[model samples]
Target: MTSETTRKKTTEKIVVVGINHAGTSAIRTLLAQDPELEINAYDRNSNISFLGCGIALAVGGTVKNPEDLFYCDQVQLDALGAKVFMEHDVLAIDTQKKTIRVRDLKTGREFQDSYDKLVYAAGSWPLDIPGVPPEKARLKNIMLCKLYQHAQELIKKADEPEISSVAVIGAGYIGIELAEAYRQKGKNVTLIDYETRVIPRYFDTEFTRLLEDDMRRAGITLALGEKVIDFAPSPQKPDHVGQVITDKGHYPADLVITAVGFRPNTDLLSEAEKTGNGALIVDGAMKTSIPDVWAVGDSVAMYHAALDRHQQVALATNAVKSGIAAASSINGIPGVTVESMAGTNAICVFENNLASTGLSEAAARELGLPVASSYIEDADRPEFMNDYGITRIKLVYHEKTFRLLGAQIGSHGEINHTEVIYFLALAIQKKMALPEIAFTDVYFLPHFNKPFNFILTAILKAIGLDYEAAAGKSLERRPSLEGK
Candidate 1:
């Protein structure tokens, strides 16, 4: 009789897998807009919505409480009319039947549920060290930084008197951050990575050299370009890893943390279309190849606006964006287009803040793009200011068209380097050229910046021009214009 009752009767039942960044965001977005929809979300992890990035800060005592890392829980979801299921793993999915078989970890009970639509946001899991027996790899001292529980366990182990040395494998963001965290706790930290440099994926040689110098100055050991062979157990405690055996040699490691990388958790969707790395392939609307099944988050491959292809970028920003897009498509919202990601990312190391967007120079070369790059080092603020600090910037562009490809920013001071990259990312998305940036209208002040913005200076340098000379000519004509 009532419109509300009619809508409820026709409401679609949606099932969401995982309760991490993407899954939770999709549920929240759908619930806020559509009260007529029935939603059920499942996650095997006991906790939901854990800030994986903040785990390092927590381990380093920057975050005093471990509980602070979690921002959402089951009770909050339940209040929002979501059928929340924690510690429940979806064993298998029957896309044809629109049903999923789920098993309860607590009660060991299994059941099947049907849905009109399904969203996959299972995220990723850390890759285990290869060639090691499962039993040996399960050593008490061997740790991971992927989950909040992992951070808790790592902190507990770090407090042990016998755990005086720590060996971190892989030199990506997580590896470097955890190494710094353990080092700050007064533990002898050795960082091992097959790559010759630190954060090679995000930064160039100059920025990485500065980070390496900072790490070594803080008494951290570097084992670059060495392959980890195996973990040797302690003579006294066979259940714990005592040393890390690499291709070069062995080093005492009271505890070992592997940050090698993460692989998308898409085994359940083996029959579905996926990228070579197992990331689910989805269209702009976050729709997978199968009808009524959508995917998002780290488990899905997104279109790279700069590269003009689909690639997997595991970041909370991408997760949230894709999640909203999927929910919007389901809710029949108009004009909700999924923007292509430029892989915009930022991280702080010691005193330096580094950020990058789009493709790097190396990435462009690898893709066989004819590109040119310019690097500039300038003061973040006018030299007249005492708070002035150096900022290094690098921009990559198409050689002929001058189309912006990517940009990287690094600064030693408290200046927001990420904001610079954010603007560059937007420019890349718009396919802007170098000349556009050179004459771009930007605010200026002596205390905050020079008359000419650094971005403009960098573009001028790339085009074989000088901003200083241009400024001088403008100043020389200022007095004559005033007389008129």
Candidate 2:
């Protein structure tokens, strides 16, 4: 007989709140570790694993099938020996008691469910404006673009003949994509944002200027540096939102889609410690402050290797990573925690390709980081190659330590090198310096890249090595930006 000291601890029951990417990842990882583990998953939404990233593709008619957006469903989870409650809402959670109060939307029945461990993956919600009154939310043709239903509504409503002019609030990825999508559908599109530059968090002014020039050339109205006040009623349809009113000016808009931002849906557990944005703070193991409780996805703030602090990065990549971390820790899997959360991202619109990882120069300076940057535009391959294309790169790093902090890649050519950001992201995570990046052994061919690729050239330029090679002299270190 096994003594009490030698007895193995078992996690028989686990409760997962929300079944988006984060919750779905956690559920799959846990079941793979132990098939017999009884898990109960509750989500307020009727669907699961609705990839919001594909919404723009769907809207642009690039994705022919809507079914392709979903990778997992409640049926699959149910068949995997885990009970999935669709349209079921978890009203409250008690970590001390290890129980949750749940309400089934179908039956309107309330009940209590017990769990040995809890994984909170509540995800995030589209940010709403406080200036716009609650009644304004009832305005017709004013929609959001986060959920599957929202995507369907956007695709359907955008095709209407009456939707001749479309205005998208917020010039972030979603807003810009939707604007370009509408333009592709032959509608006059207008993109509005308070920020002076689009995607300011991930891009600097130079990159955004190129993107903005492309958008303007495509006939998309860019109302940057304007504050949205309210929506006005059209004379034809008083109930519909006709045009968006801004502090600077008002533009005619038959339809308005708000893609302002997202806020984490982590307020359900009042006792849990959270960030200023209400995202739950999680440790390296994805465990929250409360015992037996873990938080993942956009609903939680995980430590960023580059930022050296917990931040709410609402990207599917981080969400999936957090979910895997939570489940692996619960399954007693060691050394499985994600070592990098660089917040890497990419976007292609209007034939312009852009990708970023870690931090932008503006974001780093805002956080009081002693950051310096090196930007260069050069041929992706040997200039002698007939099909060579131009690629631009910017490398940001700490001026003192020369540690890689971030990288941005942009190109208007057919052959894009944006994927090179993955290597830079690893460098930031490992705290590699510019000299190390310059020495990386990357394969090069005329069809792909030059012997000294654009990434290598960018790094060399950062540490004054490129000039050293040109002048036939060696330079020891990079010149300080602050000293300039």
Candidate 3:
């Protein structure tokens, strides 16, 4: 251990660079466990813990109170014996000297501070289109749906009568959700993406095809397999972006939202080892390449159990885990490891209840790994039960080793078998193979599941077994959507 780790101090002053989900989790954990520890946090935004996950719900009116998105604030952090400075931008980090430069956004003030420990949770920023015109910047209608302010603006634009058409670029989770949200508001919505399939990082063609069909049937233009070139300003309203230019066609849109993705805001750590995407590469203990400094939230590229490598999986759950892990490590708390994170996520959009964990079959194959998948479609409960609904579940595994790698489950009905993904995610973490999962004990209830459930039957089908004596698969059809 380094001298810094073993050294005792009356109060270790911790300077956290961000106050979002990851940063909030870390500060709360550290000060909560040891109140004497000094915690000072800085956030460029006016608020913290704005759940980007619920932005779509808020936009679609599912979440009535837009303010409900924020779970933590400056007042809460202050009450926890931590001083949080809102709208304070971190200018630079001098890792060797263990100091940082900061600027008060509200004033023209610049200052330097030293800390015994640093938590680099600067989080991430939404990706913008490259090489756009000045109009793209000045245009107020063009949106990026990743922030609380962005959500409020989206809600406002959706209510504007002039905003009749919506074009969402980058049909990933954020883009898809915003598209659905605008569509729910009775706008002409078009979801555009460079990829041929939506959410390809999670599900395979069978699932995406279903999702695409559902979106199309719901009057959402699926401009897939097309590259978005730029946003073209409206001739009538020169101050607003009115169209999206793709290589294939020019889409008319009164409002344009880009949800391409995000990049970790970890540029201040000049000497820290980072991924190809600039996410800090941290170990199991959440310690970065630099000593006495750790990274959490989207800035940390965590070890993925299924991929068996360090990857930038920037989900809120992973952020919270890494934050707690870093805090635990700093507090001398052992046996706290976030090494088994599987990138487990679920989404319910349009009519599909979908969930996925670990690597998809396509991703496994793209990596040139020997991949196999078992797919099954059946009722959630016994056929005799009048309330049963059809659910589709697929298991992806190593072809020869049979080690569980990933799983995807979806259904059109109200039945949410997504919880099954938790077990599969754990299996992936434990390196459990098909045989181990196949014979695992599971409940059988008429209302919940059959004697041999979808989870059990999926493994059985993979091993060339027929859980159904003579009956074929049965399920009711449903529309598809949701992600990240």
Candidate 4:
């Protein structure tokens, strides 16, 4: 332990450099646990710890008010004895002196503050196209839905009855969700992706076909296998028209939402190098290369066990975990060691739900693992209750030992985002065998589920055995295969 860690002060001054789900929740939880720690948070935006992810949902009319997405309020944080500094931009960090230089964005005044420990959950920023005219960013129709303020503007402009067509760039989760939202709002939504298919990073070709069909059914136009070369105002309509020029063709658009992807907010930490295209390299405890300075959230490069290297997993769950891990390490508490964190995430496609955990049919094969997978679409609940929903569950396992490797689920079931999905995520991460999971006493109820849910059933099927026949494979196997 260092002298700083051992010092018994009345209150340990801890400063968090950003405000988002990962940073805000971590700061609040840490202060709650350690009352002796004084928490100071810095966010340049007026709305700190806002639910930027739900902006699309708000535009889709799922959320009534923009305030519904803001998780942390000043009243709540002040009650927790936190000094929440809004509109404060952290400019630089002097790690050696344990001081941070910050400026008030509104007033342009600068100040330096010292901290016992520093946490950089600086979060992420939307990536913009290079050499794109800066004036294009100022265009009335050009949009990048990122912060709460940006979403508010998009909502205001989209609500206008005159705005009819939208062009969404990039086919990642955010882009897909936003496109769906705009289409739901009765706009002609065109989704453009450089890849041949949408969600190419997560889904296999077959599964992507299913999702593509779903999007088309939802009234979204797909311009796949093309690159958006440039954006210029429409030649026909000088005042309001915008053109999306791609390698293949040019399409007219009333507005454009760029969801190309995000890069980690790590420019302030000049000493730390990138671990990947979108993240910072960190140790097991979330400590950066700089001492007494730690990083988490979408900004840090995480250890991916399946791929066996440090990479970025830009998801809310991992960000929150990384933040909490950094806090615990600072407090000298033990954390659950993780071999890999690439797990399932749930996406709401209107009434339908798409969820996946670990490697998909594509990611597993791309790693060159000799694997076999099964996709089974079955009922999740009893038909007697008039409750029938389809769950397409896929499980991938090694052809030899039948050791569990990866899982994905696509369904319109009501409980798709319920506890069962989270359990499967944990199961995949732990590398639980098929038989063990199949025989496990999962909760049962008529409205909820049956004894052996579709996830376990699918796992058993992947191992080439029925649920009943796979009951004792854990004991039958002479050796275990994990992290090898």
In terms of lDDT, the poorest run of 10 residues in model 2 is 475-484
Which regions in candidate 1 have their CA more than 4 angstroms from the true location?
A: 133-135, 467-484
lDDT of 3 by residue, 102-199 (tens): 99999969999888899999989998776666656568688787888988899888889988999998888888888899999999999988889999
Quote model 3's TM-score: 0.94
**Model 2, C-alpha of 69: deviation from truth (Å):** 0.5
Ranking by TM-score: 3, 1, 2, 4
Task: State each model's CA lDDT, in order.
Answer: 0.86, 0.87, 0.87, 0.76
TM-score of every prediction relative to native? 0.94, 0.94, 0.94, 0.86
Q: Summarize candidate 1's per-residue lDDT along 162-241 as a digit string, tens digits.
A: 88999999999999898889888999999999889998877777578888888898889999999987888999898889
Largest lDDT belongs to which candidate?
2
lDDT of 2 by residue, 1-484 (tens): 4563333344468999999999999999999888878899999999999999898888889988777999999889988879999999999998888999999999999999999999999999999965876676668999999999898898898679988999999999999999999999999999999999899999998688888888898999999999988888888999998989899999998999999999999878888888899999888789988999999999988878789988888999998888889999998999888655788999999888899999999999999999999887776777576666677789889998889999999887476778888888999888899988888877877887888777888778877777635976432232111111
Please give me the total number of clashing residue pairs in predicted model 4: 2
TM-score of decoy 2: 0.94
Residue-by-residue lDDT tens digits, candidate 4, 1-484: 7665665554578899887877776687677677567888888878776777898889988888988888777668778878888899999988889999999998899999999888998888888866566665556678788888888988887788877889999998889888988898899989998889888676666456777877887788899998877787766666554878788988768889899988888888877867747478887788888888888888888776445578888888887787778878777778633346765576776445666666776777877988788766556776576745556677776777665666666655354633455666666666676666677776788787756667766775676666544564331232111111
